[model samples]
Target: MTANPLDDPFYYLNNFQRVLAWLSQRYADVLSSEEQRFIEDFSALPRGSQGLLVRMVMRKGLRFRHGKLNYGEIGDIGSAVAPLLALGWVDEQAPLGLVELFEVLLKAEILSCLGHLIEQPKARKTEWLQALEGHFSQPQTFRDWCPQLEDRLYSLTVMPLCDRLRLLFFGNLYQDWSEFVLADLGIFTYETVEFSAESRGLRSRQDVDACLFLHDCQQRFEAGEALEEVVAQVNGLTLDNPWLERRRGKLLFQIGQHGERIGDFALALCIYRDCTYPGARLRMIRVLERIGEYALALELGETAAQAPQNAAEAQALFRIVPRLRRKLGGPPVPRSLAREVERLDLHLPRIDPTLSVEYHVQAHLHDDAAPVHYVENSLINSLFGLLCWPAIFAPLPGAFFHPFQRGPVDLLNEDFHERRAELFAACFAELDDGRYRQTILRRYAEKWGVQSPFVFWGALSGELLEQALDCLPPEHLRHWFLRLLLDIKANRAGMPDLIQFWPQRKAYRMIEVKGPGDRLQDNQLRWLEFCHEHQMPVAVCYVQWAEQGA
Candidate 1:
């Protein structure tokens, strides 16, 4: 197949107006004249959206075997144009009516690139990093390629860090920066230690080898080398990038540790206070406590404890409060009160360390199948369920484990696949009118080893449970598992110490699923009671099908 001239991606984007005119004609029969017109007048869109749109078109061309775009290929084509609309590239009154088509193009490009990032990290790393360097480099080259980008793109955007980390770490530009760019790339600075005759030139490879030199300095420092000599040789560049500010706290904590090693307690405290990361803030508090600065530690630890996931740190801070009292000879801790004085080594047990909320959710979804022996093997049922989905249906945010079946956005309104599956299951069950209805219910309860007798369940209760199970189809079970897996993701799930629910009850739940032999602990019982007292029905179950282990 002859290449689509549109596929030729190049800089000098505005310079291609004449070429666009001819190519629009060449592919005129393939695309409607309206789309051709959009292509011709592409420069009218906002700069960002225009870049997004052409990139979209270039991707669309790749899916075509012989220069023919199918409905599936073009369904999201409008999204590409959307960036332009979003950026105010084109006015609402503009002549171009194919904005929707442009969106589809954008979606295609996004999906294709994301798919590559997920499936082929090593293969895509060089290109991905190069693209990033090119976008974000001065004059707009690749996108931002810093450690902070990890926090934004993967952590905040909810992209898979596991899949993209290799690319971010080992990309060509990353190697260039980490291995050769050094201080120029903005990571570290260095001093000339024993200036070698071999290292003479300005652009010598050694000048770029900042990381290696930093490692050597650290080794020398550890060996108790003269600090004055090393300090004199090291010129201070001290990175000022705003992005570096994010890691400044970590660096401060490290500096504090170094100060402590050198018996500079005041300097250590100063470095610790300069840290903004909460973990470092808590560490500072701990350091103060260790040094008999109880009052200062209490003040700092109290402040750090207000943030989420700081309970562990708070416990650490609280333990020191009494010790400080004793150190000052204020009063002896009472025998009963002594128990409340937490041991420094025996920290508050992390709530459910082995099983995370996501794992808890997946196990709940598996219901009867969660294993008793270990956390990892407990996911057998959910794993099987996940394995059932089409490979292409690999876990996607918000779509995994959802009750509804997926289709193109265009077909979603009319698709009844989920409803059809539920209705089909109903067809196989004994109806309420049948004499066997009670018998079936009884048998089901007994088979699952339920202690309660099967009764005439309320319509609402039956319907809710039916709908929940029906949502999990055998064909797309993997997607469901993917949803659960995502829900447990460290970044996505956060800490599940407490389950929060919205008024509408979307994106959160408080259901408790149990196996036949399982029993609620005291804390679990109290939680259930608390939830019940609040009038929210926390779903609880002893599923039978998961009997032998999911």
Candidate 2:
């Protein structure tokens, strides 16, 4: 692959054109009247003009200095920018505020432009901004801001229009024009999944507007805007898309958490009461407890205890319910016994400060017959990813939206496993009859560096892969994979840190290590309990530093 693929001066332009063409083809109905007109008008421009426009759009901000806009392929910048100005897309005289003007100006230019205002010529540009903050509250065109400077500043007027087109193309604002350059340079290799008509992230123009509105609300919330109005607006915006609904829920959850941080229990309680995000109920209970609403906390906690959302909520409720009962002057709730996990205690001399606890444990336990690898969450996840590649990458409707996805759009959605039930069933069935080994081995060879949501290729070496295949039981893999399907968001993590494989005996034991002052986290505890219930070999190893114990 070429170094940049920007080797072709038309690379950025080509990527932009591809996005526009994609929108023209796939998102015709979703495009607004303005967006549609812009697309049509953009197609009619000269190649150089198109290239220049794209270069400007793809850059950081709306404003670009004419001298900085030079591209050898686009020829003269003035000629390229002329057609854009005629269409009012590029405005040479757009009103720029002091802050916006300061962004494009350098230290020397700032000195030249506003030398009289600066008390110190050698002061930093940031300091100069503070020194001249209130002096130029009014906005002005670039020429007026810097009368002595000869360069023209081009401000893109249709940035919002271009942003909508971009949002339509990539399904989100985070993935930008660089995706094309990345793909061209071979930095990323996405699986080629076939798309269906039902695969659009934003299905209709209304959906597009809703998505943009929700995104704006998120920006406002992050910017410390008034809570009530932003929260009300977010709640008011009705969404038909499940994906968009999830985004809304997540944003609301963030607001609720932010409210808690600011000591606004009332606001936090208000947000969490109706918020359907995963951990909102748990947060509501915590807030109730925080504000001395013990009865309310216990009531909700008891309800949640009856049917917890997931293991995470269940674990939290266990601790919360007991405390709430104790606080409410009720009879003491009997605590359930924690399952007995195999324990290993270490007090080895600190030979190296840089090494991790897992590393120390692995080094301490290594032998010719038994070898330990610090697999953590990677090994099992990678194995599952390799064996079930076909099932995971199945091109179902709404699973894949574009060519750039590492995994399905709905990978964490509740129906993710349900939709691919049959596909996953077939993948799991291979494990029962000894065919999975070859399937996994073959996939390991073929899909070595292909992007996968599960596979940690950097962590998984060939030797470890072979060792796992030989030693690990097929039945164990099935249990793990099935549990992963149950609630992928919750179950995928919390795996044991180290795995000691007895290659000779075809045996393995997973170890969860904890350094001094460390204890088992909820997820780690859940994994340990799950392993114990299933009769899988797992242990919790504790390390106490420089103690009297020998």
Candidate 3:
């Protein structure tokens, strides 16, 4: 086997020591032997592995490590790589490698390659930028745009060996400029969206658990078992419960959701008023919106907004405010969310420049090399429209990260999780009331639809209800009642809507829904009898599906 360049202690140590000296001059503490070793090992990987390592390091940035690199490491790496890439030591063809080298270079404040790149012609520099812009603007699926993208980049007429090499890091963002793109030139890409979905401990486990729950629930529901019983079964299964801290709130919200599903507004309202966690507090606002309690939901949302500027709080407010207006059967929005999503839109300055995406094309200067082309602009706009932009509009919690890209390589490590959690909290707080709801609750509802998360919500109703009810004033809830009464009078949720409720007969029937089957469950019958015995009228009602696809 060929010896690795990094295996030589002198080579890595000498290089690593110099970088450490550079870092020490700026930092208060001296570099530890462990950190130095990690830097050396990271820099010594082969070209392909180096790319991954560099991104991993940069994502972790400036931190000491006991095990794998953590947030501090990611921060340190970012500080180093951003400048290094802009300075041009880390070429596009080897982003990972370049990131490592750049970190060292930036720490040293030594432009070893900058002197070399400066010798390139001015025309070549301009051409490189144009090619990069072209590639970025085009929107074929990420992998499909490689050929055209790489061709424009790699074929640019830059002179001097160093300038050519620097092109690598500059184009890292382009789909065609990736190491994966190069690997695909002669090899077929495995078809699947999950191509890059590697297991990272808790997240992967949660995904597995959720899938299992869904499978079990489907089986039970299909077997004519009650949905509540199935919910109980899934709720009892305890695998990895990272969400335990917020469990009470989450469960209360879920119970309220169950009430909503069964058309038990009173029960739903009671559950919404009993939960006490942040997650549950958010959910109550959503439930209120769903049951035509828009004004009340809005007030609850406003209360959440006052507590913090977190993404969840902001998103809840954002979505609830607009949705309430719509549910109150108001006129069309003057501007859709997409136009107003600038609420939480973050802008991270381009701190440095590196390789342009054409490195994939440039790599083909070797015998097996093939030309890489980036997808053109119109298509890129479409792809962003379909993928990136929609996420912005729906703005889920922790969705809008601080645009540093490349992270979570050590997800199992507690430090990384804490850092991620903290960052998520900070980002969540950035949204105002309206945007917070839009990002957290409304987006979650749309993404999960009227299902899944709702079931999750059902398990935690008590905590959620208490928090929301406590936060909102009784007068607001009373006003909401009056408005809902008006809506019911105007024929909402099918009329004759909810005239009264009575305990004598064990039920309250406001509207009787009749369909093709025209059947009622025992619960419904009990409710009807109770209402009738107490002198409340049970009105048979008919309604139409807005559309037929279900």
lDDT scores for all predictions?
0.35, 0.90, 0.35
**lDDT computed for candidate 2:** 0.90
| Model 3 per-residue lDDT at 442 | 40
Clashes of each: 34, 0, 100
* Tens digits of per-residue lDDT for model 1, 1-550: 8553334343323323433543343323333344445564565655544554433332422111112222332244345445544544322222211222122223334334343433434444444444444333232101221212211110011012211221212211122112212333333322212222221111222322332344355567568775544433332424332222333343445556777777777766765665554456666666787788877765665565565333334445456555666776669665323112111121122235575433444433442222111122122222222222222132322122111122111111112224233432342232223323333334334422211111112211332322323332322323323223322212112111222233232223344545335554434443344444444334444433322322
lDDT (C-alpha) at residue 428 in model 2: 93
Maximum-TM-score candidate:
2
Better of 1 and 2 by TM-score: 2
Q: Candidate 2's error at 94, in angstroms?
A: 1.0
**Across residues 261-299, which tens digit of lDDT does each residue of candidate 2 receive?**
999889999999999888999999999999999999999
Measured on C-alpha atoms, candidate 3 has an lDDT of 0.35
- What candidate 2 gets wrong by more than 4 Å, as runs, is 1-7, 133-137, 546-550
Q: After superposition, how far is residue 161 of candidate 3 from its true place, in Å?
A: 57
